[model samples]
Target chain A: MHLLSIRDLVVKFRTHDGTVHAVNGVSFDLDEGETLGLVGESGCGKSVTNLAVMRLLPKPAGHIEGGEVVFQGQDLLRLDESEMRDLRGKEIAMIFQDPMTSLNPVLTIEEQMVETIRAHRRVSKSQARARSLELLTMVGIPKPETRLRNYPHQFSGGMRQRVMIAIALALEPKLLIADEPTTALDVTIQAQVLDLLQRLAADLGTAVILITHDLGVVAGMTSRLNVMYAGFVVESASTPDLFARPRHPYTVGLLHSMPRLDAQPGEPLIPIEGVPPDLRRAPVGCPFAPRCAWRLESCWTGMPSLEPIDQTAQIVTTGPNVTHRVACWNPATPDEAVAARPLREGFTPAAAPAEAVA
Target chain B: MSGVTGQPAPGAAVGVASTGTEPGRPLLEITDLRMYFPISSGILISRHVGDVRAVDGVTLAIQKGETVGLVGESGCGKSTVGRTILRLYRPTSGRIVIDGQDITWAEGSTLRAMRRRMQMIFQDPYASLNPRMTAAGIVSEPLEIHGVGSSSERRERVRDLLATVGLDPDYGDRYPHEFSGGQRQRIGVARALALHPDLIVADEPISALDVSIQAQIINLMERLQGEFGLTYLFIAHDLSVVRHISDRIAVMYLGRLVETATSRELYDRPIHPYTVALLSAVPIPDPAIERKRRRIILTGDVPSPSDPPPGCHFHTRCWLRARLGNPERCVVEAPALRELASGHAVACHFAEEVDGSPEQVLQVTGEGMGGSSSRRADDSPTGRVAAAGPGLAT
Candidate 1:
């Protein structure tokens, strides 16, 4: 059995404007020791999906309308608040993007970490403090003894993020949901944090759900990857299969849009040209049809379900149970994805429909 | 001048006429620019304890019509350098010369007039734009501040500017809150271009943007540069994006420049150890190359600029220093920015040793550049791919 199974998760947020469908029928599976990446632009429902899984969606406003988050045979959505609270930091932990905002300014590193440990495990203050110190040391905090006494404001951006990791792993959770964990850090510091996360997760045999918009980060850090669009998983595959052969037009556009370090210079980047879609009203068509380069007439009628693109892709996969899948009316061929242009002779780019833009 | 880098090459007259710069002079010349913030103790009778040397002893030259990228991690003063160049923060010492005029000490009308030729595009599009102001008002504010044209004329120009920056002219009436992040940034770009500035100091303009929207802004900037003969000081932390847009790239470490070269030259043949490590650290979006690469992950957080390590500011976290038997000279004498072959400049004591070392971290060879051949490192610490593409090559 899979470690975690999220089936058709549909999360909605009641805004002043309208009910925004934050996540629409997003489903995926996580193995015991897998690292899955969920990548997309802002408002693409990657974070909301994970938030729904953790049962940590904002109070009242955000609601999981329909979903079955089956974790180790128990439906996490059906769990009561008290049970959910017990599982939060122990079975599942989260690391937010900005450490400054996530951590309490008034509390010392010791107080916060010890409190988390004590809340989960029935340990005394000193024992919890010792575990906190050990975790800080494991995450490579210099002089954990003295650093633990320091307030959140005293640590540097990188050090503060390290402290956050230390706190999150204090209970040795089976699953970790890191939302843009290193986005606020610099390249070197990001490298350090990602390396630490990867190494520690491997050592602990922990499954990680790394939510970030950076393609480079997902490419290196994640074994399985999901490309998200406006409230939908547009594509899902193993890291190698996803990069080597992206079938979805949105995925292709993303691959071509980014300026790669190894890309040939002066090669013009083909950016997806349009404003991001509004989630206030759910569209009848594919969310990415407006920006897609390869779209068919059928794309405007209905949203395609996440289905397999290549059956043979799972044979040489890096991670377990990762099949190459995409949700699109007209998927791009490997040649089209690589060249980022039409394979046929008389091909024209897909224009945004008039109503879509307005 | 304590550490002036260079003079412009003789007989370079391409962009002089457009910008009114004298022949053989770069568009922007910075000499030993130092910006230090005072640290205080007591609230009422605060004693100046020390200085947070944000940008200390930096020199650079950007030719007319050139996009010079100043790249470094946070707290390395890349943004401070950009702000100091635009005179946002008055430098504690050194000179800033623009269009052959020394504006380091210029005040009142002179500073205002100098500001006309130079402008800045800030990092955060959301925070940068005034929420209360409409897009038209925000873009037209620069023109209005300079008293450039009549009310009607300014209105017309604002509409034109919006269209020029790829925004619909009709969207001018909407406030910043109404527009998306990408559209908001377009308004910011339009505002910067209102004064017809010769140099635009873009301080992490695209960093706040999404990966897809970033290309639109970069392409627009490139097109504008070509059309208006504009020079740019592109300050950013993303090495890949900086390389994509910049002609010359400068690497900063703890307020001082460690390496500067043409983007092609710097990536292919990095001399400074810090540059190599930085190149290695940036995770590229290619799984094939990522699987084979060996990241030289620097061990520690960057030291605080207020109390930067003596001698070499980077010696505290430098991977090369430890690999080189912990040289005493690195911790005793600060290296000056010395010119190497052609346009390349490096500030390092053991640069020759670095030049001779394996391109363990840097293997991103530019196509058609025959000088440096990229080959797989058989001795990479990480597992290696036999023949992956030469990208994400840490």
Candidate 2:
């Protein structure tokens, strides 16, 4: 059974310049202990979807027009503020990218952490401090006992993020939502933090919704990934399967466009043409059709719904199956997937090779 | 070498094939470039405590029409090197020779003339472009500052530049806020190309854009380079993107050049321990490779530039040092950047020994060296002497 299932989530922002459909009919499911990655570009509504799930969207500007976020058999959208507050830290915890801003500058780390622990449970003050210390140590912070009294400013950027992870895992929430958690960090620090988060989540069997723009981070960490483009999951599949055989044109375009370190020298990058559509006017047929290379004539008239591409070949697994699902008018077949390989010698119409600068 | 059609041998001198022309030589050459910002204390009687050595002794040469990538972490001063080379900040000490002219200490109109030859594209397109100015005004401001042409000619040029960067000419009347991040960057590009610069220091031009948009900008830059025959010093933290766009990649750490080699040689066979760790830290996009590969996670954050470590700046977090039983030489002496294989240079005490043994480095790290005494004792002196080869040590 799914731990959290989002169905037909439609979200809009009531801005001064007309209504912006941030998320239109978005749906996905997450099982316990499974890591789900929402991979997309900026303003693709991946973060908005997670925000709607947490009921953390900023005031009257944002609204969930329709949809159901069923979490542990409860519709989060219908829950009251008081009841939702109770479920937030204790049931579902969140960590954001900028730990500096997410954490309080004035409050001591100990006070903030202890407050979180005591809010969920009727624990004594001293007991809460001890628990906070243990949690900090669990996330690999040295000298947690003394570090507790210090403010967030005393810690380095990486250590402060570790503190954020500690606080999120303080109550042992069932689901952990990390939105671009290490985007601000250096590559070395980023690797360390990602390792720590993955290890802690695995040990505790916590479901993780890892949102990031980096396909590399998603490939290494996530078991299942949902590629979002223009506020919709263009493709969803197991990490390995998606890398091996991407069906959606958008997914193919993304994988091809990202210059790979492993690619041969001077390999041409096949960039997708045009920019993301303006959200003020909703897409008539397909949002990605304007940028997609494999758009069919019918794609100009109707939007394609998410449908399984090869259901018969899917194998039953402990978590979600590797069944490829893509929302594309003309998705790539398994054989045609190889055609999406990085350019070797010559350039195609999509990939214009610049003469080597030297 | 004669039989090979398109392949240049690894580490072949990059600019030997160019025909002698006005700007055909190395466009920008720097020798021991350093830029240090002062750290002051006490408001009433502010006294200089120390200096943040942002760009410490960086020496590099960018050939005309070649893109040289400068990559490092955030506080590592890759951006400082670009800014200093552009004369935005006067270097603490070093020489900057651009297009056969020494503009390092040029005064008055000479400096102004030099600025016209070299332009900069900043990382944040949103902040870089003035929000109040129209796209036409933004692109044409440089032309006006240099007094390149008449007002009507500049207006026509602005529209042409906008079209050259893949933006609609009609959109030139719109303000910066009216445009997207990618469009604003195109405007910045058009501005940089306005004066026909010989060298363009693009400081993380695509870092702010989305992944899809990043590709668009990269392709656009590449196209512009082809059409204009431009030279670039691309500074960025993303190693993969840097490698993709650059002909030669230089890895920096703690404001010093750690390694420099051709793009293929650098990625395929990185010698420096810092370079190896950095390359390993980058997670590949393929899950099968990512899971199977061994990663070397550096232990701690980068040290403060104001108070960097004594000897080798990377020694404190060096996995190789610990694996080699905490080499005393690494702790006592700073290694100079020396050529290991042809044009591939590294600043490490054991670059030769560590070649082709990255997996061993990982295994040693995984074994929990703990500064153990059981390492091969004989490996130390040979590494020291080999790295301290003829003319390597200052």
Candidate 3:
């Protein structure tokens, strides 16, 4: 059974200029103890989707306009403020992008962690402090006893992020939402943090919603992947399946655009042509139509709903279960019929060489 | 200037060589460059004592139309070196020669003219671009300041430049806030290109953008360099991105260059312990390889730049130093940046031989020998003479 299910979710921001449709009819599910990677560029609403689920969107600016966020058979949207608050830290916790900003600067690490622990639990002060130290040590912060007295500013960026993770995991929430957790960190620190998250989630059996713009990180850490474009999940599939046979033009473009370490030196990096669509005005058709290299005329007139491509039938029917989906009318396949069809009128398939297979 | 093809012809416009005394010289040469900001105490009366020696004695040579990548963790002074070359921050002392001109001491109009030839592309696209101004206005400001042309001519130039950088000319009137991160970065690139600069210092130009967008900017930069014969000092902390674009890569540690070599050389056979650890840490996209790779987890946080370690700046956390029995000499004296092989320079006391193998050469020279017992015992007069090659001391 799905651990968390989001169906036809729509989110809007009430900006001064107008109402912005940040997320439009987006639907996906996270299985129990599974890692779902949400990949998208800025303004693509990957973060907004996570925020809506966490009910952490700012008032008067953001609100869930439509859809069901069913977490373990409970409708989060139906929950009152107090009811949602109880569920937030106890059941579903979130780790924001920047750890420094997320942490309380004035409070000691111990004080902050203890406060979090005591906030949701009926525990004595000493018990809370003891638990805080345990959490600190669990996250791999060195000299936990002495370090607990130090303030947030005393820790490094990586350590501070770990502290945030420690606090988030204090309750061992069923679902952990991490929004670009390692974007600001160095590579080494990023590797450590990612490894820590993966290990912790496995040990705790916690499902993770990892939102990021990095495809490499997603490929490394995630079991399931959702590629978002213009506030909608353009494609969704198992990590390996998506990478192996991406059907959507946007997904293909993203894969091509990445500067792979394995790529030949001086090989031209294929960049998507244009920017993401403006959210203030809802897109008439496909949001990525402007930049799609293999865009069809129909793409500009009407948006395509998520549909399983025919080529994925083999994997989709497998025992482990593969639910590969793409929101594109003209899905590419490695067969003669699809390959023979022109990407664009008067556009030859041979014109754009498939440089790297992988 | 129409259809100029932007590529500087081989040996074209040799107006003035930076090192005129030495024939066939590099276009820009920075030798023993240092920029130190003192940490002072008291408000009423500040006292000078300690210093954050950012960009401490860096030496590099950029040939015409070549892109050199300066990369390191944040606070390693890669950005400082780029800014210092542009005189954004005046170097404490060093020689900066550009086309035979000693720009290190150039002032007033001379410096302003020099500035026209050397421009910078800032990292933060949102912060760098003026929100109030139109994209056209931002791109044309440099042209107007330099008195490149009349109003109409500048407008045409701006349009052409916009087209050159893959932006729509009609969108020139649009504010920076209206553009996406990648588009705004294109505008930044167009502004940098406004002066027709020979050298561009791109300081983490694409770091703010998304991964997909990063490739767009990098590819655009590569294309622009080919079309315009531009020399780039690409400053970035992302090793992978740097490797993708750089002809040569320089690794900085605590404001000093610890390793410098060709991108291929650095990636395949990194000599510096820091470089090795850094390379090892980069997550390979392949899950199979990623799972198999062992990450060299460096212990402890980067030491405060204000109170950098005494001997070797990286000695406190040097993985190789610890493996090499933590020699007392490493704590007493700093290692010289010496060229171990062709185009590969490393700064390490024991950088000579890898794992104590006889095939690896370990030789100390000059003042380096006088300070260390290990070096004195290991060094011969013949070895000292051989190691004292060109640009060895600096």
DockQ, per model, reads 0.56, 0.47, 0.29
lDDT of 2 at B245: 95
Question: Number of clashes in every candidate structure?
Answer: 1, 0, 4
CAPRI tier of model 3: acceptable
Candidates sorted by TM-score, best first: 1, 2, 3
In candidate 1, what are the lDDT values of residues B257-333, reduced to their tens digit? 99999987777667787897787677878877776566666767788899999998888776567666789988989
lDDT of each: 0.83, 0.83, 0.79
lDDT digits (tens) for residues B1-394 of candidate 3? 2222232222243312321334467778999999999888989999997889888889999988889999999889899999899988878999898877889988888999889789999999999999999999999898778776668778887888898898989999999998989999999999998877888999999989876688789988998888778889999988878888999999999988999999866765567777766765666554444433444556566787788888888888766676567888878887889998899999888775432211122221121211111111123221223344332222
> What are the TM-scores, per candidate, against the unseen true structure?
0.92, 0.90, 0.88
| lDDT by residue for model 1 (A1-358), tens | 7789889999999988999989999888888889999999999999999999888899889999998999888999999999999999899999999999999999999999989998888899999988988999999888999999999999988888999888888888999999999999988788888888888898899899999999999988888999999999999888888999999988898898889776666878888898677899876788777677677666776899887886455432225456788998788988998888669777665665676657
The value of fnat for model 2 is 0.75
Q: Supply candidate 2's per-residue lDDT for A353.
A: 17
Tens-digit lDDT string for candidate 2 (A1-358): 6789999999999999998989989988888999999999888899999999999998898999998999999999999999999999899999999999999999999999999999999999999999998999898888898999999999999999999999999999999999999999999889889988888899999999999999999988999999998788888888888899899878887888888867767888877777888898776667887676566566665778887886566533226575678888778666556576333345222321132111
Candidate 1: TM-score? 0.92
How are the candidates ranked when ordered by DockQ, highest leading?
Answer: 1, 2, 3
> What's the C-alpha lDDT at position A285 in model 2?
69
Off by over 4 Å in 2: A311-320, A340-358, B1-25, B356-358, B369-394
